[model samples]
Target chain A: MLSPGIMGRSLLDKVWDLHTVRELPSGQTQLFIGLHLIHEVTSPQAFAALRDAGGAAAGPPGHHAGGAAAGPLGHKAGLRVRRPDRTFATVDHIIPTDSQARPLGDALAEEMLQHLERNCAEHGIAFFGPGSGKQGIVHVIGPELGLTQPGMTIACGDSHTSTHGAFGAVAFGIGTSQVRDVLATQCLAMARPRVRRIDVAGKLSPGVYAKDVILAIIRRLGVKGGIGYAYEYGGPVIDAMTLEERMTVCNMSIEGGARCGYINPDEATFAYLRGREFAPQGEAFERAVQWWRGIASDPDAVYDDRIELDGARLAPTVTFGITPGQSVGVDEPIPSPADVPADERAGIEEALAFMALEPGKPITGTPIDVAFIGSCTNGRISDLREAARVAQLGTVAPGVRTFVVPGSQEVQRQAEAEGLPAVFRAAGFDWREPGCSMCLAMNPDKLRGRELCASTSNRNFKGRQGSPTGRTLLMSPAMVAAAAIRGHVVDVREEL
Target chain B: MSSEAKVERVEGRGCVLRGDDIDTDRIIPARFLRCVTFDGIGAHAFEDDRLQAKGNHALDDPRFAGASILLVGRNFGCGSSREHAPQALWRFGFQAFVGESFAEIFFGNCVAMGLPCVTLPRAELTRLMDSVDLDPQQRLVLDLASGTITSKLGTQAIAMPDGARRQLLEGAWDATAVLLAGGDAIDATADSLPYVRGFAA
Candidate 1:
């Protein structure tokens, strides 16, 4: 019974309507994907399924006649892999950043990498490998190379694929099978999420970054607050942010329980795309910009729900527990079990036990054994520059292992050209290549048992850092740099 | 057509596990997430830590051999929106998930693929996991027909959100079922709505 002329529609509604294939009886829309990104970690099985189905169709009369011929044939094909052009593959999770040598040290890692390389080549899909200059974290390369743009629907196997939303795209992470489905059909049937507007008015304080804004938002809204909603981040603060800073905020949208988060395309967005590699040339670019401008939410846009935040009131924040929502300001004390909500009390207690922290204690002085400043979430050149600025000021504490990993080869090269790597090395930190180093521990960078680390990555779930008992303290990259310098979780603002 | 289509029942005893924030990587590591076939994923589910643990064999562990339902603690399936987590559970013979809560993407994917996820009180989940741990052979029954979860030790009725429950009962995914449910009314609405024409292209 809804009217079509709902005066002002948000960007989410505009994109949703434009891409919706049809409305079904279930009230969900069948959405067509514009872009699908795959990685080694999630697509091999899908291709195999496609081949098995094709093989079944092309079999000879006696192919299935004998016992030996049919002896436990490990195959079934329901997936189609014909549309390789719609899919792109990248090596991130399992590739070690320290070495560009041919054979990866871990046999399993090497096998996965090789499988992806072979599969992409066999299917005619473009792949960004370790040696490829374009190679970096899947999320980073897409935007930096102008592959991700306004009004497109992008999907990837990795969760942070939502990072593409900063470019005014509707992006979400999918599972392996879903990745396969997109590889086959370049479409997915998805239920449209209700739109929520998160308005952050006013200017941010000096030294506060996009990471601080997102952490503050997550802290206010419980980790599960945005369930079933697509968040539209707007107002003065969001409008003023650079494209990369906006990406950092939207990248962690999943952590705040939103399906995805985005800002409307504006002059900043158009300017960011103006000179990028894959951006449309000359007149085409101007026409594309017009279309993009039309899609931005009107001044009087309506949303199912709206929440307003004051940007000036926020400060650099850090998580005290396993969940991203379990965070406090850098200067604040960790909440005691009694202070937690009744529904979350048990989880809080469990996190406390696992982290071995006392309630009401300040996290600022908590000792750390390791400091990691890289991940798809916060491993860009700006993040590196911020950390390097801190590193250049002081040396890493003795006995503390510090690693500074850029998000991509381009980021590494750019940092090296800026002498950021030298700054890190002088501060006693290991400056490494890209490829998701120490983020999820698929590579050599991992925490030993019971080692406490100040990490800039997204998740801090038990055993997430490789060792079952390893403890991770989630913080901003600058905070991690400060922690590395002091061998403890020190407030970066105080150090500044 | 007669309503005599044979229904395949996915039935088995449930093995309960209690843990918070069990990520997709833990359910099925990114390494094992590659294959297209759902087959054998069940065997390798939880391969990373479960197989690496001393004196433990996750695949051969009889306690979870044929479990059709999983009872878990808060924030089940929290990290990563990897669809393989639910696919692995489905392949492992789990038809239903009982937890205090679920990650949004995990819950959405489960619903789309016909995997039933039920949320109950944390106390109920704690009790269920405790009982199952005490007796490995304890059997739990999840009745989608009645919207109830019962075990030899206790029974708890669950309330699924109206939309999702209806979707499951009708065995419908995507928007086709919604339109079909509305039948002539949807057609009439579509005809009346002029803006629908703008979206056609």
Candidate 2:
């Protein structure tokens, strides 16, 4: 076992150094990507990029063998990807989360889904298709299946791919070209991002889950606060959280504008990964745990920046406006322009105007036409359990549409095994299949007209949930369930 | 693998969008993501905002209708990892964007698609935005070779990191091309990985 010396490095640096295959002539590192997770939305073009290269002599102009090197420095274009085990995919973004009926109503979505199926089949890549039962949100399936592990560098086309970092890996969301880059070659050329240590110490008060804690951090940091840095979350609060809770925290790293976010592996992380389908077995499992533990940051690891927050001070937070950063505690008021910093005032005002929210009005009791509990952020079983606890109390308020989407089929099965679905349905919630529903509205689950929603999803961007004028209130699932019951945004703490 | 794609400079009419942190969601809503290709998304660029403001959104304004060069405030394209955001802009005829700042992922995505995202000093950005917003017909020139955005506001030093600037001017962002070009080295790296064997993977 290795002992910590006086000088210590952050977990991100440790993972980054281990994953570097080689540094390119341009000084960029060729990061050896351990896992490449893709969805229907981003994989099509990447696969096309591959086929185009194979037929460079007789392909489209974009598919030229050597890319049109009209510039000073020539570029590389041919793709020779032969590794299939390293790639995994699923259909979540464009699939309906509630049902599996063939001949989907949206033909374009169906086409995209079918294209993904064909691409995966042709490539020999593992595809968790509609009937696989293993199918679910890419982020959810990866963790539950033991695919996301410590000491690995994972990349996905979706921004929320940062969720894997909870296991102490350097996971990040890459663009489609990078997706093709990884597919064609199991490496992503990249400059490393600096690290920012976010420390939230102390035990959380009752009713404040990991979701609230992350929302609080995003609130303080603002959306662009982490633009050029990777975030390392630690301290008593994060350390005390369950694996699912940790994932919920790291999921929104992209929303904070950070490339990725991670927590060092520990006993809890080992416990979560042990005995899983993909995790090493028997003695190998013990060896894997040892390696995972060895990768944790040293006691005195240095960081590019550090932020300290008191977890006890955070309340159930909700976004009152367009961006995730424009949030406040459920009990707090929609901040007036004068209250926010001068630079942020314009954005705050713009959000207020778009939301039809008045300054100084309490964020609580803002009418919500929809209450959705889904997305990679808060769609895990614990999220379902917490929301079900509230739903078990009472039926939903009349005329308020609500959905409870499990993050994965496995999660849905677990929720069903525990009768969570019955509790939600009894309370007038539409408990649906596991997929990213209402989160991005790629599926049929969506908001309509100028309806305002209380969402457990990560983003509250304009039209995030489908309707152009629809407003979103980002909060925890329990808070979303409470909102469904009350027909407006309300603190789950009071309900509890 | 190599690329012929290049962006030495961009010459087109300039338009101004006066907001910071304009995210990918705002640029191209998720509803438009169902297609196999990034076709027709250009028409729906800022579709949600354009609809919400009853066609009064900046992208909807008739004055900037034909503008191919977008001048934005800081932190443009802040949210989402979707390359569709830049692709949509490309389809909409955006050759380059000169903003006060850009999100790392958004800038990288743009660079991959051969779109130049350059930043300028706050004062220069203000002058450019005001000038373009006042006259949509103003021809704006973004010279990546010299790192300058020229218009009636004159040539102001556009701030782009040496690496990103090199990436754009050299057409080196075709990552798959670059990776494939590495060829045997990539295969050798794969062969050397401990967990990369038949079942180890």
Candidate 3:
């Protein structure tokens, strides 16, 4: 047991202690998972593994709960979904946002979805199927539906699960094997990471968004910098960010090598969760707020490490290379391979050659073949509103393909109600339904050969946008909107 | 698939990939992840990179054929928590990894599958990589009990969390049954928490 008063402790330390089920003999903490989120791409294999492990003594497949006793195969098909009430399922990664037709066009995708649907049905877990108006990127829907809350440990198959940490929770992504672990035992074996407080002092400039703020952080701290640490985002700048903005920041914490990231719960967090579908109601909500407030890092909290940044000085940043950490400000020239240390030159050269970029040239004015403004990173209503505002400035340029995919069905509904879709459509940006459309390009949406894109999605890695030789420059949604209009990378500030 | 599987030692030839932040997307392209299962994923490991390199990539190199120990640079496997990445490597015949560092989720996935992932300082890893490259058939042994990687040339101290080391040594890397054994504690913890109880104050 931990004494919060004996020593000033961080939010991570407090929340972790609360969720510790027991310490395993392996010297890892057997942390209880409060909420386990699963998607189509990752869950099928896990369920199959469970079925294989459950065997005949566990009963026939699809035998679960009360049904385990009634099935002809016998009373234990081994539907080992411990705490089904705590688990939620959705179809995202592989679902096509372009169509809502039953039995997906891709037979393989259809089969995967069927497996998930069947598994969820047998286990008595909730599934946000297509047209359910709840299906979306796992990270986006979790917070919107209020399944993500403060002082909870949230795990999902998708890497962007860190998005839930914006609610002042301990959230991280897990692999399918761990997903199986959670499904079978409702717990994960994990080692506690050291806490690092990243203080972003001062206010950001007019054109800079939360996306840029995160890009700036990743650029300063290399992709591997946070390997063994959890980032606690704070200071004046973070205090001023809205909940959605905070989500955008935390969503890419994985890109910076931190599996988990969080901001202290405040009135903004409480306000955002107050009336959501699953949040505690009435007096219970107020009591929950008190608990959330107490879990925040104490004033005298000790941290393993501390980092400070002047957010006011950050510009509209864009990644010009493979990793998110390889980025630069809009007006700044790309660093020459010769300028960096010898050990890093190879990586720089690889990026430059792959991106077909010349060192020392400013990234501004680089032509783009396509523009995308959606992903878990910047697909909320606020992101759409921001991009829509820029969309009103001008129509998309000739020969520059553009798409604006909403993060979730709720976000799409809100944007449509606000006429944001019409604004985008009029600007020549294809307004699409909710799903992670072009972020990883797993579905129908993809880039043609050797194309360059200005994207709002996370990860500018090689072939990330579907074309093996395609290039991606990641920026804020507004920047993506500006690029769509101009047919090249331009500062959103100038467009405004 | 059984809990009896242990990974105390991984001794085999080493394959070297010298790059930082080598991401999962490059390891196994998203296009290959459309399958319902991880079967045959090994053939597609580094699909795009191998295509671009025209069989010149380490995974494609004939000299390192059947190598089971992977030597990589810093932050190896740094994107996407897709277990498919490690599954691909495991299927491709890799049993252990020695790198300057590794992404947390990727490392955990490897551990869950009973693979041993250890780290070394950048210089030490470079030396191991260089020695292995000069003689592709060189054998390396990673012993969790001793916390060192040994080779014909020399032995170097390796670093991994003691907990992970213990898990590998004790064959308890399959965590489901172990965690499920503590059902009472899990329920007690869940009950004591306010959120699961609807925030009863």
State, as a TM-score between 0 and 1, how close model 2 is to the true structure.
0.94
Show where candidate 1 strays beyond 4 Å.
A1-5, A24-27, A55-82, B1-10, B28-66, B87-93, B108-114, B120-201
lDDT (10s digit) by residue, model 3, range A110-193:
888898899899878999988688988888899999999999999998888988999999998999999988887788999999
lDDT of 1 by residue, B103-147 (tens): 777886777567778888877777777776677676677766677
Error of 1 at A58 (Å): 12
Candidate 2 achieves a global lDDT of 0.83
Give the range where candidate 3 chain A is weakest over 10 consecutive residues by summed lDDT: A59-68
Better of 1 and 2 by lDDT: 2
* C-alpha lDDT of all candidate models, in order: 0.75, 0.83, 0.89
Top candidate (TM-score):
3
Q: Rank candidates, TM-score, best first.
A: 3, 2, 1
**Lowest lDDT 10-residue stretch of candidate 1 chain A:** A63-72
Return the DockQ of model 2. 0.50
Candidate DockQ scores, in order? 0.20, 0.50, 0.63
- TM-score each candidate: 0.85, 0.94, 0.97
Error of 3 at A404 (Å): 0.4
Q: Could you tell me which residue pairs clash in candidate 3?
A: A58-A76, A58-A77, A58-A78, A59-A76, A59-A77, A60-A77
